[model samples]
Target chain A: MPTMTDEQVRAHLTHEEDLSLLHEVSMKTAGVSRLEMCIQCGSCGGSCPSGMDMDHTPRMVFAMLRAGMRDEVLQSNTPWVCVSCYHCVVRCPQNVHITDVMYTLKAMAIREKKYRDVAAPEFAETFVEMVEKYGRSYEFGLATRHYLKHAPLRMVGMAAMGLGMLRKGRMSMKPRTIKGMDQLTAILNKAKEMELT
Target chain B: MSAYTFYPGCAMESNAKAYYTSLMAVAKPLGINLEEIEDWNCCGATEYVGMNLIPAYSLIARNLALAAKMGNKTVLSPCSACYLNLAKADHYMTERPALGEKVNEALAAGGLHYQPGSLDIRHLLDVLINDIGLDNLKAKVVRPLKGLRVAPYMGCMVPRPDYNNRWSDAEHPVELVEVLQAIGAEVVDFPGAATCCGGHMTQIGPETAFELIRRLISSAERSQADIMVTVCPMCQVNVDAYQGETNRHFGTNYQMPIVFFTQLVGLALGFPPDKLGFGTEITSTEKALARIGVDIPKPTEDTPHKQAGLPMPSCLRKNAKGKVQHAEKEAA
Candidate 1:
């Protein structure tokens, strides 16, 4: 057997060993998440307006996190269903940062490609692309591209509303790129590089 | 006039044009000077954060850096999402040094750096209620919206996770109701006042959004509200632009007109309906305005022909299945 250095062995073990899912999420979140303080009181699930739509309530998801069901937790639609309303965050008995944790979960899911639905991820990707490109969101471009790619049939249904918006000059024909595009791009690129590391 | 660095979010330039128009008309009369930030960028809304952290924080921080550079102490955002994103970034960066350092590193590339907590981030509603004062607003009302009944929908972002402890209550804030009452309008007891408006779920999960939208409209209709007054552009757009689709999905006709609170403020301040961006909402506000003796010109263009689509069968069937499952479990 090839002799492995202590540093290499520790690194291998760290990669192989499963860190507590709760710890991973809490670390990823900004500020004091206090996710580990959750007592699974079901307030988060009960408070969520989109709770019914979620495959698992946030309370249940936290329980699953404790059980280290990484795939099931990450693949669940609960994170995507979260609208970041912060109702649960405010109502949590443990004062857990529920909404911030949800954001962290979403980022992790997107990074791991473990999300359940493409629609939410795709829409977010498109929105981010526009913000990155023009430094402004082009509603006209976002709706057109999203609808064409995901729901062409619904685009027909949406035409009237689209036309109304267009007539009212609500939807711009072209995006307004910021004058400091180079600066913004450079900042974004640096941020992107830092994010990967 | 007290000056503020205005961050007109991306929505303000587009679908929420009415909000922009009305706000501009009312700001001067209210003794407020809204200085548009020079070359302000998007706040990344709710999406960019879900994709990456540093970039999302940096995107918002860039705007903050610019506002700081412009020597503005207060940054005012009308859009709820923008307000939350900006406040959240400022709060988190200040609370967590590692994040602040990383964000500043990225910002340094563009010659931008935000000193966390250097600026006071506030929502438009907050300013109208706190700075402008209800008493001052009441005094300026040239035309009282006495007969019009409006549901004060504050949406989710402005109140919750309030970093500065500005709002009274997160769950059921009285600020919107107070503002509407100040303008001499009847404020309905709206239960869905702080409920989620489904956000981008309308695009990603139409069925889910339709149900959430249905609940809000049903409650407002139950209260016999003439219109829903909202402080957030996303709330107005979701409840107004998607009302028709929500109705179609649920097989219910709900012609609930949603308007920006700023538009109503402009009206009470005696600005003409056209100037306040009336008739811009997808749900026509003609009948609602008629209640208060305000006659606005009808939109000249003919309504586009709508393509008929079948009602969403799965959502309906899913409700039925849920009932059956609950019954079975109870029996077991």
Candidate 2:
């Protein structure tokens, strides 16, 4: 992908005219009252360790959210790259739950099926699938499946580390499921059913 | 013995086996009896909350409900993600009654109920530093890490959103240093100690994650630390596993052994290297552990470094004849 020109940037389709997106985000994130309290101080941007990777900083994202740019917000790589480090949440003078908001954005992306950042969503999907299956994260299974599904070439490189850990007894070949899995599944199912309606 | 329900989380049994092993070694010495929570599931990590708030919190709350049913008031977790999720669920459920009702409705199918604030979710580091006094920890030290300069990497989760007012300081908690100093290691003032490791970003965006990883490693190296000691399994795995990739990205050769704090404490407590499982790291603890006179096996000679990140295959410029005209350039 080549860098976009000034004309391309101007021509970029933005849902800035969509007011419903702001109301929706505000309702979901009403808990973080600081969503409206952000002063646009660049502390979050400056303090972010992975800010360079994100298309928009925390401050920018908040501004974009308020501006009702639904497509722009969804297309930004900021939320997917958020590792939940909480640097922005803690440092915000307004006490905004920036990390949690990032989670909200990530969830919105997945729900809307709009993934700007390609790999993170796959990792999240692989993680959720693994947990939904055995009630625990099986590293060998997760790594094998994640690499195979996403990047098969990298699996060759990962073999040495994966096999080394396996030989060292750090990782296991067998999957581990917790007791009372039926009850756990019932609880999860109930939650899913409630979310639908 | 102070009793608490132990939530080892999902990683303990697999990728972070060393943490599990070392924590087990210290349990007896610390006189803190940890009963394992039966049938504990995943905490939904950082993903589930974004997809659907109710289910994610409920999944984490289910573990709390299980612990409460066991009649335990406190729950201890070694994994940072587990600790944060458990604590966050308990906190949020109390703050939002509607959320609490919805989550409880989900739990009702399992014939269970969780009362917010019923369980005290604490990180293992907090337990070791607070419940098991540093004096006792120091007294139990058989092999002190006297000359080893350690960077206490608490990651980011343990400190923030203290919701319960447990951590002394959100930004700069001295818990790791206090505990490490008791073990006789010189703990450095690491600025990136509290900074994010970009969590699962290495998988999402390698370049993005690599830069974040380099910040901590290079910061520790600049501080002249021998090794980095961490409290969270994710932090340990991220710093340890992707360290080679971080080095490759920056064209720097930094062989920092990112280890679990418990492994170091286990060594200081006179636990055998094999018993503590110190050699399971990808960064190779040989150089780091050697500073404390505890020798571990090397990471094997065939693999010069641990396999991590995306392998950069070399691309060549083609001439008219298609013969290799120039040295192979690293593919971007």
Candidate 3:
């Protein structure tokens, strides 16, 4: 029940050679990720709805990071399969920021171009491209591009439903451009530049 | 009328148009004024944040800056992803000042600045339950949804993370139940209410999403829910649109209609069903509407039937008087 100061909580350095992966992941995560505090309880895995589909559970991923298994950790489909439901996040007794860690792992994998499963990352890239271009997501365009590239045959199956969505006035044919696209572009460009530093 | 700046996100204009229509219909009667942020962009959903931390935060922060500029103390989002992103950006910025400074530097490029906590970010459900109040809603129910049994599905994003300590419990929040009960709909004991709806995985990993969707629809079927009511557009889209595909994957013909909570609320408020965007869902609500009569028939049995188990955990049950029994008292 005792509360610690922010300085006290963040003062400890976790820089052992084997712990380098853990340290980088924690640092890259937006806030204090508490990745080092993991007890390897498997609460995250137990609570994850898609844990069955993950090659390694979140706890295993954390353990792998501590062991500096960079290639295995990034190559695993665990991060890509993560739906960001945050079930593992709240369930983690150590408060390891499971979902945020997944995001960081995903970004790292994308940067290194080391992922085994390409569809999820490609989807993310396609989505980002849409956002960067129009300041908003065009689901119609996104679906078309993604389905055609990744699941061409499935796209044929999806045609009926897509047409249904269109007929019911749910899907828009054209993308919406925000009035302040120039402003959004400036901020995004600056952020991208700063991300490099 | 309480006025709050609204961030409709991209889904409202397209896939979740019914949510938008139904929400607007109920807002006037509920004494809420939703002033949408001008020229607002997407919150980047879950895609941008995973790609680059800085740009994701910057993109989301842009919406916050714009909302703050509008002079509203509270900013509301209807989409769960947008709600989470907005709240997460503001929360992390406050929790880590360095990140805030970097994001603010990005904001400076757009001639905007966000002071992180200046505007309170809230989901539409939070406003409905907390600001609008269940009692007020109950009084306005011109046509109680008497026979309609709905599975109140909150999805995953809205309840978890507990950023502002807003939700009652991370795993099983009863706010949805309280609202649904107020409108006179029979809320089923839906265990999958707070579970994942597979999100954008339908596009990237169809098999994974199909299984997740199967679990939700099958759970609803087990409980005999007439329809599943969701707060998130993504949840509705995944469950309703891909339901046929999910059935084909599993070789099971389960026909569970997924609807926005606002659509049901609009019906209770006596708006014409068609006016509230009723017929737009992929799985039709025609059968569900036929069940609701003109009036709520009083329960013939005086006491509400208790779940046939070890006293149906207090969060999952309401007492005979239609009040939630506190867990401690129930245990005693």
Candidate with best TM-score: 1
lDDT of 2 by residue, A111-143 (tens): 787876566777877777777788887667777
> What does candidate 3's lDDT look like per residue over B213-232, in tens digits?
99999999999999999999
- Best DockQ among the predictions, by candidate number: 3
Ranking by DockQ: 3, 1, 2
**Each model's TM-score?**
0.90, 0.88, 0.89
Model 1 clash tally? 0
Q: Fraction of native Cα contacts kept in each candidate? A: 0.65, 0.57, 0.69
- Model 3: colliding residue pairs: none
Task: Give RMSD (Å) of candidate 2 vs. truth.
Answer: 7.9
Of the pair 2 and 3, which is ahead by DockQ? 3
Quality class of the docking in candidate 3, CAPRI style: acceptable
Q: Which is superior by TM-score, 2 or 3?
A: 3
**After superposition, which runs of candidate 1 have C-alpha atoms over 4 Å from their true positions?**
A1-19, B300-332
Instruction: Please give me the DockQ of candidate 2 compared with the native complex.
Output: 0.32
- Model 1 chain A weakest 10-residue run by lDDT: A11-20
Model 1 interface DockQ: 0.32
